[model samples]
Target: MKQDLVVDSDEALNRKMYLVNNALDEIGFTWCHAKLFMLAGFGYSVDSQLDAIQSSVKVVVDRQFGIDFPVATQIFYVGLLVGAAFWGFSADIIGRKLAFNLSLLLAAVFRPYYWWNELVSHLLAFGAGGNIATDVTIFLEFSPAKYTWLTTFMAAFWGVGQTVAVLVAWAFVPSHLCLAGTPCPSSENRGWRYCWYTNSGIVLGLALLRLFWFDMNESPKFLVSNGRDAEAVATLHAIANKHERLCSLTLEELLDCGEVKDAHDFKTNGYTVKSVFSAAVAHVKVLFCSKKIAYLSTLIFLSWTLIGLCYSTFFNFVYIYIQLHGGNTSGSTYITYRNTSISQFVGIFGPVLAAYMVTFKRLGRRGTMAIGAIITMGILFGYTTVRTQLQDAVFASLTYFFINIYFACLCAYTPEVFPAIARATGGALGVLFSRVGGIFTPLIYYYGLKSGSSVPIWVCGAVIGFLGFIALLLPFEPTRFRSV
Candidate 1:
């Protein structure tokens, strides 16, 4: 009788894994619509930090606030540094749903007060960072193994945010704003205010949608890890029902797997700061205990650091770089925004293209990453030498395209590389280190630009290419193992 029960349980679990591999089964409602809402929310959250600063608000600060606008952007990143660690850690302990909900709430609360002081800017950035970590954590938890690649593909929405922000600026800023030097009344220079207000409204709306309409459940995997076997099985049923498919998993069958142990006692025995600290330290140590995992972790950490530096240094200053080189010769803000739109338009295709490339047998995740990085390096080098508008546009488009491909692979690969129990912790550490790199970027760009225009390009290009070779050292290729 015991043997029969074990066999039946194993069979049910196998079916579950098969369904996961086949993409949670019956794709339209569960896989498409639900995922789209999540993606939209993520895009909007990311924009609240980057799009607001670069597009209209920076201009408003220059004209009306009498503050150095660049400092506001820096302050946002500093907030991100703190938020990433906190949200990442919170997701593991408090549950993904709670962390996800609170991130958007924080973003909405702090964003309206951005120009008030640098402290608010940091707080808003904190929300942005939390949103990023929380978004990726929950989204990945719900995704089926076969479709995990979609996690990376969703980054195309990052470009969507950029394009929309540019269009908004083009529509309102140049048309309604007071002339550059001639300061004017608040009523006339309200473009930036309008931009921020609209962004905050969108964020609040998404938070409501998530809280009420979306009806997302806690992660079953997390439940199992915490020793809540019944809850894990129940959550799986909820997921299966959402997909309009039948799930045969039961609590008894789940316990038979034995991989998941009840950690309730471990969790509740001694809830103290020291215990929490010790647990965190132990989890990090596990990342390096295995030779293969240790090497892979090191490579991934280094790659994120390099990517952060390159991304912040280049994209943060793209507007100024273009304007200096003749983008503003017409003395029209429209031209600058239009060109920015073009770059984003080209970038939108990159993640999709990367997703397709990874599907090929010959060029899986590693191959795609290596090729994308190499291409980006060459494009950046060429970008520096361009003098004409056409050359600038062409090289800039190519640069963004390759960089997106690289990012799609890196972002998708990070969560997959870690064990389920440690996934959130691993991802948070990666974000923390990357933000550290970003914290240093403003200094690097300032000095590099002072040295020469080409200096920043060379520095960014070299780091990207060097990291590509280091990526080759990753111990486990996702293609070699089944999707986690």
Candidate 2:
């Protein structure tokens, strides 16, 4: 009888696993495509607004908003923080598919609203908040075991979107689009508006596609934990069909593994805020209780924060510095902006390299991260001493390269370190901390420039590099560990 029971359990586990894989594969495509569209909106709209405000034509309006820029950025950052906190918990309670669909819907609706006058900032905050929360969680959950390296590639799609935006802006809203006074030119008129409209259209279309075509399903692992053996088996069978792969287990094997019982009991009659909080508490405890996990989380969090601060600070002020040192002639400004955009495009290469290294070569997360950090420090240190335009360009390019590499490694490493229950929450918190670093970066850059010193960049680089070094000591190397 015991042997029979074990065989039945094994079969059940296989069926459930197959179903979960199928659900993840289908939803993953939708999630990635939608994210690409949403990121396009953010890239075009936010960058264009910043550009417009910097131009003389909109000086008065810009001043009003400039005074409010810090506040607006903060609002956006806080919104992301809230989204992370809310959605991370929501994924565990309400179900991943539901939270996933809702987030896309929220982003689709609000992303385009940013095109409306004076509403852009508010809409951006809302859309981005939802986008980050849902997308990050879903990506982590759906990823396959061996192909975990792909997670960062999915997230790096944001950089691709940003690059596309730069190309579009250059084509449509070229430097000649605006001029001081004289009512500006026709081409420049409402160029920013067009950018926002396009972004909105893309998001709206993706939202529609997801709403009509995507099916809702719970994660099989989640189901097993909830003691829904039959449902888990059904879901697993569906997955095997979707993937066209034969599963190895039988129901008896699954039951033998003891996945039939509820992992834990809930006191609440229904899902509530209190219930979410209790789950979050349990999740957090699991993450911290493991020394290896705690160290990994800390390292990832600090590294992301530093990367966010350095990259944002550098890009935000690059144009200003160029014009100051190279003169504000139309040709010079065009060249400067073009160069800055190219730098961003080039930055993509770093992550790509890091991805290849981690995935193909198996440098392991910690090793890759450490190498990236060292390279990043070297680049930043070189940047501070460079005075010539050519040198600036070289240093900037290298700085971005290392930063991207670091980000790629961290993106893959963070999700793998935490338990599934807290994975999204931990990822969100890391991003939130990074945004905090980003918020202060501009202020530091502004002051640094005003003071006529390179101290700020040097300080930022040193801090980040040191943190990366510290991250090297973290335990729980994901490559050797089993899934939580």
lDDT of every predicted structure (CA atoms): 0.64, 0.54
What is the alpha-carbon lDDT for the whole of candidate 2? 0.54
lDDT string for model 2 (51-99, tens) is 2222212222333223434444444445455555565556665655665
**Which pairs of residues clash in candidate 1, taking residues 3 or more apart in a chain or in different chains?**
none
RMSD of 1: 5.2
Give TM per candidate. Answer: 0.85, 0.77
Q: Which segments of model 2 are wrong by more than 4 Å?
A: 1-71, 109-120, 130-137, 175-189, 212-216, 225-229, 248-269, 318-333, 360-362, 385-393
RMSD of each: 5.2, 6.7
Question: Residue 236 of model 2: what lDDT?
Answer: 54
Cα lDDT for residue 181, candidate 1: 72
Q: lDDT for model 1, on a 0 to 1 scale? A: 0.64
- Residue 61 C-alpha lDDT in model 2: 30
